[model samples]
Every structure is written in C-alpha cells, then in structure tokens.
Target: MADRDLRDCFLNTLHGKAVDKVPVLSVTQTGTVELMKKSGAAWPEAHFDAEKMADLALSAHTIAGLEAVRYPFCLTVLSEALGCRVNPGR
Candidate 1:
C-alpha cells in the first residue's frame, strides 16, 4: 500500500479484518529538515498555516512510502488545541 491508496486496508486493519499486508500508519511522522527545505513548509509556519502544514504532512506519503498520512500533521497537535504554544523544531 502506498499511502493514498491504503484507505481500505487501514480501515480494515482498524476493524480487525485481515489485509494483504499491514498498513503502515503513523500520526507522528516527522518532516525532516531537508523535506521542509525542499517543500518550503517549515515546521513553525506549518503549525499555523494550513497549506504549509498539508504540504509538509504529505512529504512522508510522497517520499517515505507510508501507507497513510495524518492530515495537517499530528505532532503534538493537542498542545496547540489546548492553548499551548508549540516550540519550533522536531
């Protein structure tokens, strides 16, 4: 499964159903510094900008072969949601 095409496999795995292969999923995939530079979507900016966040979040799917991507990126997202400032860097 290659990220965008693994929706059914992911859902099936969650439902305790068997799949051809285990879906490679992650809610905490880090966007490397190189990826940020390549995509022009820095972490600090991405945290606040939806487009930047989406671009950075898709890096893993496009480059790493993740079976799925956590939309808007899911790194410590709750902290921001709970009114805490997220510090820059991985």
Candidate 2:
C-alpha cells in the first residue's frame, strides 16, 4: 500500500472496516519531552492553542513515526472548564 493510504487504513480500521493493512496507530497522546523539543511544541501553551496542539499532534506522525495524530495533549480541558483546578504538571 502507498504511504498515503495509511491514513485511510487507520480510519477504516478504527471504524471496523476492511483495509489492505492495519496501520500502526497510537490512539492516546504520543507526545514526549523529546517530541516536544524536536517539534518545538511544548505543553501549557500547546494545551491551549489549537494550532500548536495540532502541530504537536501531527509531530507524532512526522517525528515519532506514528501512523496517526491524536489531540488535546492532556485530559484537563473539560475539568478546568468545569471549575476544577487542573494542574498540568511538567
């Protein structure tokens, strides 16, 4: 399969549809301190900025060789919005 087909493979597999091959994907946040530094996308700010978040998410694929990109680096947005003090620890 072509490299570009990986995206469809990932999506099709996610929806339980058939594909030429199963794409290796991380459904969870694949970011690391290494990836953050390499991609120039750190936390705190990336957690709030949509563009930064998307860039960081895409870095998983571009930098870490992951087949897919995930979003919302941390799980604190909803909690924070709900008035909970979300300490996004470094």
Candidate 3:
C-alpha cells in the first residue's frame, strides 16, 4: 500500500497479498446513463468514437475515484468481427 499504483492494488488482490485498503474498482462494467451524462460521453457515439468511449471509461475513475478503468463499452465489440451483426444500442 505504500506508494502502490492501481496495478499494484489489483494484482495484490489477485495474488492474495495485503492491501492497506480495498481499491475502488468494479467487478462489472461501469457504463451507465448517469455516467454518460456526467462525462458527456453517451452511447451510440461512444460505441463508435474512441475518444468518446475513452471519456466514458475514464468517468468511472474521474467521477467515482475508481482505481481501474474498464476498456470495453460493450460485450459485442468483437461480435461483428466474428461474423455476427452488431447494432448500436443507443
């Protein structure tokens, strides 16, 4: 915990090591309508625009002080690439 970064905090938990305090992180996806409004990174657009997607991702940390950032906006990102039709759930 002494001068530990987020990676340290997360890795420590996975490895059964000690943390001074539990880091703020989500066990699930962090995207939500409230976060979209707060960060001005709504869906549909964020689904396609990397910058918008990044804004939404960072909101979890910037607004809630999470120790980590979740990178995927949708679970279907690779669906289209894998021969499935993907539609934006705006």
Candidate 4:
C-alpha cells in the first residue's frame, strides 16, 4: 500500500499536480555531545543514535522554519565504509 501510494504520488507530480508538504533531511557534525548533555541524555553514544540525532536535527527546521534534518555525523564513516584503515582517536 505504501509503495502504491508513493507511485501514485510520483505519477501525479509528473502530471503536474501538487503533493503534500516537502520532507527534508539534513546532516550535522559536532555539537551533538553538547546538545545531548544539555538535554540530559546520558551514555556517550546517545549522540550517535538515530532517534536522538533526528530530534536534534529537527530543531533547525522547527526553530528556523527551514525544511531539514541531520544525518552522517561521523566524518569517519565514509573512510571506514570504504575499508580504509582508521585508528580510532588518531
């Protein structure tokens, strides 16, 4: 049902019809620890979790009325995912 709905929505747009609100995703690095600390979220990696990260990212859109969210806070993920050797804390 979701797939069909999405297809219909896309088709309608191709035919020049309006859809619902635009969804946006934004990514951020740094400041997570500070934000988490202020929000009283313990655990060092709570800054790395999706839900918490999304909550923090959504604040930009909420406060500034800009459509955006946060993603890929780790600068190392690209290197790591590509199988490069990364010594942590280097």
Per-candidate TM-scores read 0.65, 0.71, 0.81, 0.40
* lDDT (Cα, tens digit) per residue for candidate 1, span 2-32: 4444888878899999888787757665577
Residue-level lDDT of model 2, residues 1-90, one tens digit each, is 555787778778989998776677676667788888988888877887887888789898888778877787666767987999976765
Candidate 3 residue-wise lDDT at 76: 85
- Model 3, backbone clash pairs (residues 3+ apart or across chains), number: 0
Q: Any idea how many clashes model 2 has?
A: 0
Compute the lDDT for candidate 4.
Answer: 0.52
Whole-model lDDT values for every prediction: 0.74, 0.79, 0.82, 0.52
Q: Count clashes in each candidate, considering only residues at least 3 apart in sequence or on different chains.
A: 1, 0, 0, 3
Misplaced by over 4 Å in model 2 are 1-4, 15-20
CA displacement after TM-score superposition, residue 43 of candidate 3 (Å)? 0.7
Error at 58, model 4, angstroms: 1.6
Q: Which ten residues in a row have the lowest lDDT in candidate 1?
A: 67-76
Candidate RMSDs in Å, in order, are 3.2, 2.6, 2.4, 7.0
Candidate 4 local lDDT, 3-67, one digit each (tens): 35555665666688887733333445433455546544323344457666665555444443334
